[model samples]
Target: MALSPKTKYNIKRILPFGVIWLILGALFLTVEHLALGNQKNALNSAIKLQPDVVLFALTGVTIIGLLVGCIEVLVLRPLFDRKNFATKIISKFFIYFFFFLIVILITYPIAASIEMDISIWDQKVRNRYFDFFLSVTNLSAMIQLGFSLIVSLLYSEISNNVGQNVLLNFFTGKYHKPVVENRIFMFVDMKDSTTIAEQLGTEEYFKFLRSYYGAFSNAIVKNHGEVYQYVGDEIVITWTLKNGLRDNNCIQCFFDMKSDLYKKGHMYLKKFNMQPDFKAALHFGQVTTGEIGVLKKDIFFTGDVLNTTARILGLCSTYKEDILLSKALAHKIMLDNNYSFKALGEHRLKGKAAIVEIVSLLKNP
Candidate 1:
């Protein structure tokens, strides 16, 4: 069986977590090897440094990393998804640290037994394990381990907060300078946002938007969309031309978002006393992408495609349509019988001399 795009994306996201831990573990091992190479304890017991022991330690750390990454992604993230940044970092750190301690307690004894060529239950191996932890060396090692774990957790938090793609770009300097590329833009805006805001008031409206965005995000992820920005009740999603056109992912994303929102209608009605409706417009063209801002930098996209998409979205109320797409994008998409397209005819978009063709996209009943 083939993996879905969403599943592939998730595995990609979790991979870095494991890699970070593996690197840190190697560094920790190197420091320990150098600092305590064949050193004698207060008991005057000397242990030789063997390749198998080092390999076992690395394997243990790798397993711990993969397990922790899985727990952080599948369990911890969703549990604290709504919490503030500081809260998430602090809470997750302690939780993961506790698990780390448990892993160390179990694995250290086994590692000691391997080095001594004895059963883990042997009295000599038991004494060696306890003595190793009670020593000043273990104190220093624990401090190093704690610091390393905190750093790894921070990376995970920041990656989740800023988005994985954005963080990778920042690290890889992929868009350090402006570069032009063809891309597709989707401007999704909630209908009657002002009315909803006023009806719900400030705090309630903020909560509503959180719920609204959260509900729609899964579909975007499933369809492999990169979120560009969120301004008020409007979210800008962008994709490489190839990614957007593949299997008609761009169009499918909009419909999937609608279905997801509809499924959560009861929750919305109960919480906000209203169900949210939205409109989206899609367009494709060349855009210049680069890092921008001084004190705080971000990957910014600049192009007429974005403005054109927003303008097309503005016409949604006029046409009484929920989803609209440019003729260029519509032509590029490979649609099946599940989708229906209606020609809304070419129209003069705002701040443009040339008329652009537009069409409505609908799900077939």
Candidate 2:
């Protein structure tokens, strides 16, 4: 399977670090060869580097660098992406340091085998296995550290770019503009919002509303429902029977929303001593939908269906019902499963010319 968008983005972001590592590895080989006077024989009076020996050493450096690059690109970047900037940076630092420590561990043995003395300058002329390994590992680590710093900086830049693009698109673009068709629209409003606001005060009440709205919105998204608008205490959601409304999924979504609200409401009650209740009205029928407006555009539905949904919501107050659905919606839902609903008979809705059948959703028990 292909990687998720998040994973792909992280891989792209860390690709530069891999390139840097490869470059540094190549440079270390160059510097080492030049410093040793390009000698072919280690036993010669002059430092003689064998072509085969040099090739093998360079190959080892290349492989080590490649491994480091793969780790940085695949493992480190993905882990870092999930965290905040400061945490990500700290994590990258520690991971890179750990890798450097590994390089040191491998280098120490190689340096000892080479018999390279740390105390004197000419004593380092002995081309021992330990010395060769230490030199390459140390240089590779230095190069890796430099690349890590660059990657850390680049990661920040790329993250900012992604964040800005997402915000720009969300605020500006027409999001999932629905096709014009008859469908069910539900508007759920918090009961006694003004009184709750007054009791909780401005800041506390606003926070409560935010949490409540956030939970509901997330539920709507989970149910594959589109939230067209959020007006104060009310959230207007739209779902098509043909496409948007999946009986099992949509019903499950509402249950999930209630569960989320129940948990959150109890938390708020304990913390701020505030009680929040919800009332919803659902109606199904023909409606026109698309992106509307020029300066500040929004995707909206307009028709008798929307009007009827609002009226049904208003009836919640009179009927003492938590949720009220139109006959059309109730009929459709009944086709899927046995959900108890009490019919309220045909009644004239405000602003509606004809009478509409309404039903009260009953507890499953």
Candidate 3:
């Protein structure tokens, strides 16, 4: 079967790892060849660069990558979403142990079979099928390979936690210092957030928030929204101007998040006795984007646009509206027919002398 969208996205996130292990595999081959120290006969040298060996090494690397990637995305992603640090550490230890062993079992057999064939064909070494299997199960090799797999998998867990793009920017220094760029910001917060938190009590309410954000994450990725910050009960998501306007993605991401959470209403009601509903405010403008920190670096946005977008969302409760958009953002696009808009009229927002036009965006009846 073809990969699901989520699977495809996770795989895309893990693609660079394939090259990482490919390099390691090549290095391992070079080291092994050099370890022979001029003792190599023709067959030994030939065995070192054999096409079958290259395929075996690369294939093994790829299988380990996919195995670790899938585990990180499908299994560990949800596991880390919970608030308990102690439980996560304990659970991951056992989970990874068996999972990596299973990966070894599935991949090693085929590789070992290939190596046996290559040996007989090229070096005229006679080895029984069982001997090939035994070589694959060699204690030292398995331990070293398994250690590498565990280390790589653990790195994946950390990378996933920091987020894919955030890690990239950290290494590439894409925004080491502030740089101005046009970005669209969507400020989304739970409706009646205070009342809901009180009703659910502190612990349950936090869990609700976690689950709610988890639901929102899927929709944001589906629409290509990049999350900038989470302030208290609100989350600030952003996009490049082009990406935000490409297919009305900024507008659609809000509704999609709502739909996802709505579908989980029953589960929320059963567990927390409440379901979440969120309101969003959107605006497009210039912002300074870059990484900042002395001890712990992080990618951050700074500009009036960020402040203005927050103020737009601050009006949602005042206007009693679910979706609000700045006139500047609305004017840039030819909205699809599925959407309808209402002019909220220009208003002089607090702390601003000039009036800013606003609109309510809604689905067509």
What residue pairs are clashing in model 3? none
Alpha carbon lDDT of each predicted model: 0.85, 0.64, 0.75
Leading candidate by lDDT: 1
lDDT per residue, candidate 1, 146-232, as tens digits?
776777778878888889999999999999989999999999999999999999999999999999999977899889899999999
Relative to the true structure, candidate 2 reaches a TM of 0.54
Clashes of 3: 0
Q: Decide which is better by TM-score, 2 or 3.
A: 3
Maximum-TM-score candidate: 1
lDDT by residue (tens digit), candidate 2, 237-275: 766776445544445556667878887867877887875
For model 3, the run of ten residues with the poorest summed lDDT: 39-48
| Alpha-carbon shift of residue 356 in model 3 (angstroms) | 1.8
TM-score of each: 0.94, 0.54, 0.84
TM-score, predicted candidate 1 vs. hidden true structure: 0.94
